[model samples]
Target: MQRPAYLHASYRYGFWWLALVALGLLALGLGLRDPWPADEPRFALNSLEMLKTGHFWLPHRGGELYPDKPPIFMWATAASIAITGSVRLGFLLPSLIAALGTLALVTDLTNRLYGRRIALLSGIALLSTVQFALQAKTAQIDMLVTLWITLGAYGLMRHALLGPARGWWYLGCAAMGLGIITKGVGFLPLLMLPAWALLAWRGKATPLRLKELGLGLALILGVAALWVVPMALITTFGDEPGMAAYRDNILFKQTGKRLATAWHHVKPWHYYIVSVLPWAWLPLVLGLPWVVPSWWHRLRRLDARVLLPLSGTLLVVVFFSLSPGKRGVYMLPTSPLLVLAMAPLLPGLLCKRGLHWLATGLLALLGAIFLVAGVLGAAGLPALTELAAKYDVTPWVWWMLLGVAAAGLLVWLRPRRGMLGLAAWLAVFWALWSTFGYQQLDQTRSPRDMMQRVVQITGPSAWLAQPDFDEEFLLQAQQPSVHFGFHTDQDAQFLRAFDWLTQAPGERWMLIPQRKEDQIACADLSQVNDLGLQNNEHWWLIPGTAFASCQGDASAAPLFVAPTTVADAATAGYQPATQQDQDGVTATPEDSGK
Candidate 1:
């Protein structure tokens, strides 16, 4: 069958229009929100610290050496912050540009292989996929890593097919090297393995000479060495012993430990196949089940298009599964190939009766979900209060129902436009969610409001000590807080830090979480003000005048007697009120939104 005329002719040019839509989707909420935790504030704070300390190679979190990641992504983020002068805007640019560049590369690659129409569609598929868009707007390294991996894949494809000989190999290997620095396992040659296997099967692997392969490997090592060499020199020979942790983490823990015995984000072996990929690459995977037979047939015949993506995707899934440390986003580098694998089946899917029914059912299901959410949000139901408490989303979030209804109508009236309609529908929801939902989400996630109250009460230069400190709160407050200790471990470091807090030059204000107030043995303490719940954790501002438990300071000087118990502590302007609405537990006066 001849390809559609529109696929060949219309898409031959003006494909960049799709890139604009992607940019808009990615940039919608880039600067409107403060960095939230779990990843954002960690990286953002690290970058901001780097900017302040002029230590570009070493990454720090809350003044402690943080070495879970390489510095290239943070360097880019720091540069962005430097240029933009806003942390929110600064940290988001690298991912946004990487996503846009990936889309451009995908379009070009698809155009070469499957014609311009499929190329454009693949780009659109990538843009609207929930995980891709979500990661692109985040301050994380996944999107940047994916960008390098995609470029490397493109280079490998060029070498296998229409390459200018050795340059393609060098280009691909160099890109992968950059990926390695961006993320620890960016060196996974998922693209190269499949491309090589297919070429070897067809007796066309001679284009990749052994001499060129060695050179490419050398280039990759050299590019990666740019940072690793300097970093190794500093950490090995520097005065800071804490940097040994950083060096060990970067060289071993970040990659090897994560693969073998991950300290965090561990999951079952089948997590990727059973949980992650099915939804992470959605819209592309929407009709995938119905098209698998066609893919299977193509694969059985050794079709390069199907084989390339199949082998690459299989290798990545297996490699990640072998590692106990699994995250959904870890599969992001293979997402472009997943999109590519599905792009060729679009025409078949458009005609498949099963797909038509499945798509319509999905559209109806989406409409129903939005309809219920809108009804609940508009009616101001109690059930939505929990969601609202967490997301801080407004009644305006339900406005997406209107867009959903419009999309349903479009699908009903013009069934042939179902795919485009579905893409538009998802795009509209994501945009609305990002724009309106993010506004409230930001307010709730941000500590700027609560930190401002602290500043107002204590003054800017007041000696502030947070034993169980939150980096996000500290970053947002822009306060160089005195770190007493961490909640997780109470080692000698904690004792020394606690002693420092107790014996500091002047009186200190301890910002203790209300739950931990009973744990501190401090005297002459008084309540200042309640800084409302952040991430559902309630904190109280307690001013400590005397250290009750200093190791050797029982008879040093006469300041005040330390309290023996929580009952002995004094409270000023303290009123405890329990409101059972925000969090599942009984909310304290802190729930007053103070």
Candidate 2:
């Protein structure tokens, strides 16, 4: 078979070019987009809070203890922010480094295990995997945890391949310890046990002295102790409620409690098998059937290198699957192992006539589907409209159709490297989507613009308060005008806010939930604007209160008409039809106090 154009590019210009392209694509939109709600903003806020408080040992959010995760990610993000001073750039670097570093590690490992061709292929495959790419760009702890797990796994593999004299065991354990502090399941690298056992059963064991193994265990504990011991000592001795919650949640609820009975993300045993691996592993999933059988044939020989990846992959999958609390990102550590398992088979598979046909056909089908949907969606077909509406499908999505069309054309024109071409095409598609399309979507979902509108209406001299506001609003706004009050069961919270609004000597603006409008209505505060956030949540803003005159005319229509952003049309979440302000209030010209 003739070498494919992409492979030829790799052979001639060197595959580092491909790696650079992949990393560059991953880094494309890092500085442009605002922090997304739910996870992104929360993580970013925690890091920012850490930076503000100068309390590096414990992570807090909005003046409260945050124990859902350890402080490693926050520490890293805070350090990045301290140095770079750009929230987007700072919060993004850790994940980017982890992702590119993982790719480099995979390349190095594969090159050692197989050869240059397979190493390049493995790096490309792992980099372009849908979940891996998405997680790398996200400001979450998953990618950081993945990095530590990958390092730990590589260290163990080195020991297995070379010998105990190398101390790869200790290095691997230390990485796993770092992973644990980064995320709770850092010890997942220990899944190598089953892999080592498989090899031993096949008489391929690399015997290690008991002392060395003990030392590795100690290293893991020692790394964990650097944080755990300090946190425990301080929180145990201190009477601070937040610190206590942090200790309890981090040590138990986030780990043991989650394992025993997770409150969120509860899924059935087959969740990973059904929902995660199939999609998360994507192009690799398509190749697994061929790869698995080939590995199975070699199982009896139990080459340490082959057994290491196969067993580690199976163990991680099964372990996460058994947990009732499962998320796709939890299994990120398996990406490299899957890449390793598939590398030996890739050369032959790349040259296979049948695989080439499969690649071309799949790409063509996907392209045709995208083309039809894009045309229909553009043509205002109700079915597609409803579907597009359900996903906040942006006008920019037409670009994806172009991408799909290009991918299809490339594969058809160069069938010899259809798989590689398709992977490269998808990577470019994702990069472009994240770079441009993401901002378009974010403009609607994120409250950054909405808050800016609030600041505009209220002006800099005015004082603004959001009682029990989400961190996204605060972080994105970044204005001293904003004041936060803790949400609680007490009615005094509302009374205090109303009293403040009614008695404040100057203009006092507040963002309140629409549902609570009745509670503060007696204050006679006039509604200025509103914002619709994710999950059917809506907030209303009252301009200022000094006059006892109550704009109690509750029937006023919305003064500000929210343009139908693409998100409003696409999201399944309820979009209020009234000419509502972004804060979810209907304002009339009469009520605008003009």
Candidate 3:
């Protein structure tokens, strides 16, 4: 069958329209809310502290060296915050830019490998995936790392499959190096080499040259040294107590040991295969039945385009699966390559009636679920009512879900355009979730309001210490705060906090989460003031008097790192706690218990 001229022209221009739509979808609610928990606030706090302390090389969180991850993502975030002068506005910029960059790279690579039509479809497919959109809107390292990995793959594929272009290969190596600095998994794109070698063996691709390979390896090393050499030099010679540990931790435990002898987030090896991909990949995964067969057929024909990306993605999945530790976001870097491999088959597969119905049915099913949940929630059903009370969400959230349900079902009801309707429904879901949903859930998900209440209860002059605190609390704290350490043992943190509180009984206070109240051996939980629920945890504000009966741990000295700059307090609309007030205040033992 021949395609018409108008359809051809539409295919040529479709990606631009998709790009604009993606920009709006990914960037709709930029500055409307504070960073939420789990990872966002941690990264945002790292970026803010970087700007405050002017420590660009080694990132810190709550005034302690953060050694879990490299600082490239934080560096980008700090640069964004520096330029915008607002964490709310700048924190998510890196992910947004990286997401857009990934889309552009995928589109261009697919265009070169396939054609304009496949390229457009690939972009649309990548944009439509749940994980891609979610990561794009998040202030996390995964999205930025994915961009670098995609760029690496793009460069490698271009030179290996399309040409003997040395520049592109070197560019790819450099990108992989940058990815390594951004996240430990950035070297993932190099997995494509085995597939490239297979292509070369099949006489379908150029053989690797030793000199070029050595130079490319050198490029990767050189780019990584940009951060590595300086960090090593400073930490090795620096008088800072923890610098050596930070050096060793970031270089070893956080990388190889963390991977091989994984301590956290452990799941069975089939976790991704069984649990994550089916949902995380979304509309793309829905087509895998057809995609898999087509891919096999292409592989049989020794098509380098299909073989390279497919093998790279499989190798990445296998690479992570071998590790005891697994997170779904660890698979993010594989998405662009997966989509590229799927691009050539997508046009025909998308047109299949079964796939269309499946996509539309999924959309309809989601709409029904939302509609039912909203209706039940509005009717004060016990499950929904308990959920609302637990999360402190309002009735309007239910109403908003109803709206999303209505919008999605309406699109699904459209005739013979199931794929288009599915796309529309996804667009509505993300747009609403980012803007309306963000505003509605911000109070509960974020610690901003909770911190405000703390400040109100304790007064502006009070010096606060959070023991075993989440980053969101510290980021949103309106008072100048001290923390024992982020990774310190909970009981040890409380012991240190108790000692610190006794130093200035009248002026000092401790904030503790209910989950960790067991660690407060010295404090009377009854005397602790409840600060209601925030971020799914009950926080207590304990006046120094609450710990007055504590046995002294005078020898237990904790690292008392105060914010280098309390400008964030000003930004939060409170005066920074004065050092004089914190240090000069002294109360007699009798007055302390008052």
Candidate 4:
């Protein structure tokens, strides 16, 4: 089959237009600051190895195969490294591109299916979304995974509904498979593809056979196997011992690891519900009564466009709800769906009284919240102080405060504006503070900063320790010529592996943030040379005598902040239960438009 000229031409040049725009915005969001983490620094180091060593299959750094995620981000980043010779820039640029790809996908797909106005708004909303904004630029694979999933969803739907372009269907399958490899099991969105195709084809019996779909799946699986099979085989040769452990981490444990549930980050299913409220505010929050009204109108007139978004909203929330663990940002992928489901139908959704309320009353409500929070922040400092004792006032809380004020201003300026007002306000709020303010509030910067700092002080052989991926700063700072934390040791990841926390500090070395603050086995802070500082937080964190000889436990004072006592982690809004390996119970999801 000779490919048609128009389709190829339209996409070849046109796709880049969208991609370029997405790329530009991505760069804007990430700016010049280093990556932030729980996950990003490790991702950065993984790619750095792919660059430094020129090995694609086995991701090793300092000396170990890294495991938190598969190699898609690393491969993408590594490719960048080959061209630019800069590891951080290489890894970051691709993820930024991928993240932008998502917005482009959202805009074009929705625009083709719906209209340009709705498509534009949805894309902007997705890009501007609080969580999406942060994740897309942070050099983590989750955004890439999200990009793959979203693109796959768009491709899958277009193939199933618009018409069967076998190529498009195959691409959908391929994208999904990559998505699976990118983050494990997220490829399951493919399961819904056929049913959607059926629905799109108006229930027509057709030649879109399971067998052909099987081939497409095979193609995706094959690409994945190329990477997996080699890594698996080479791992047995002692090239990648962690591969076996990672296989378990990826395949069974992440989903099934419940034996004593080594981690304690689990939270109640209501976690997202409570978390989203602050971002959503009274208009959306108190607008709960309106969900029935919105659902009722859609039901009255079976609108496919409205239903599509509603379906996405349901699937995203329901899928996560069923998961054993929860993070607020997990629901971020479906943010565009929320706007699509509700905002478009506003004119139709409002009955006489409802219209009046959506116009006048909602503004009034937001006004009240803005005034109240400000009054509370200024006047009720005592209550806030007490609350702060329980929960360190996280950056998100302040962001929410700023968002509420911005939302109020938007509403006051234009009550009938709908989501445009919401988007504008949120954008203003984040732009103002994300660079300077949020950075401070966030305790963990990506290990890039930490990595760079360590490089300045110590050469390759300085012994170091890392309790977790906290060494992101160190890696970002420079390539290791010698052994150090995050790469040197990952055993500190297990809460029980406290022994791994012990390390010898060299005269010139300091521990990466991930390393335990305790004394290194043979080194003393008293014996160390000062290396000046790392960006902001590292300035205050002076190295000390080895953990074995510390006057007080390091946890009492972390390398950066005045560390809290053991009683603090739980009482101070950090949920130990939130990290539980056990799955959270599923709750009945609230109706979509609501």
Best by lDDT: 3
Off by over 4 Å in 2: 1-15, 382-393, 396-404, 407-416, 461-463, 481-508, 513-528, 532-537, 543-594
Whichever of 1 and 2 has more lDDT, that candidate is 2
Whole-model lDDT values for every prediction:
0.68, 0.69, 0.80, 0.51
Task: Please give, for residues 332-366, the per-residue lDDT of candidate 3 as tens digits.
Answer: 88788889889889778756767767877777777
lDDT tens per residue, model 2, 1-594: 765545544444446686778778887776556567667777777777666557678876655566788889988887776665455557788888888888888888888878787788787788878789888888889999988888898888877765553467788899899998999788987888766755655568666556777888899999999999999999989886657766887899888889878888999999988888987887788776577778888776666777788788889999888778888888888888888878777777776666766666667667767666676777788887875565455552655455465665674567666676668667656866775676557665567657667667777456666666666665655234433233343244454455555556367777777777666656554444656544246677675553255332212211111111112211212111222332456333222211
Per residue, candidate 4 scores C-alpha lDDT tens digits across 1-594 of 332222223333444554555555556533234345556555655655554456667665434556656778778866764554333234467766776777777777776766654465456556656667666656777777777777676666566546666777778778877886787645645545544554546653223667877897797788678677776666656543456776666555654553224255576666666775346332343344666577678645645455555666667766666565766656655655565566564333333344434535444455456556655655546766565433334333453466476556654655444444554555555554544444553334433333445545555344343334343443533322222234333332322122223344233233433233432343344544443333333331233234344222223212211112111212222111111112342111111000
Name the lDDT of candidate 2: 0.69
Of 1 and 3, the candidate ranking higher by lDDT: 3
Question: Residue pairs in steric clash, candidate 1?
Answer: none
* Residue 583 CA displacement from its true place in model 1, Å: 37
All candidates' TM-scores? 0.86, 0.84, 0.92, 0.67
For residues 356-397, what per-residue lDDT tens digits would candidate 1 score against the true structure? 456556666677777777767677777876767665557534
C-alpha root-mean-square deviation, candidate 1: 8.6
Better of 3 and 4 by TM-score: 3
lDDT of 1: 0.68
lDDT of 4 at 139: 72
- Model 3 scores a TM of 0.92
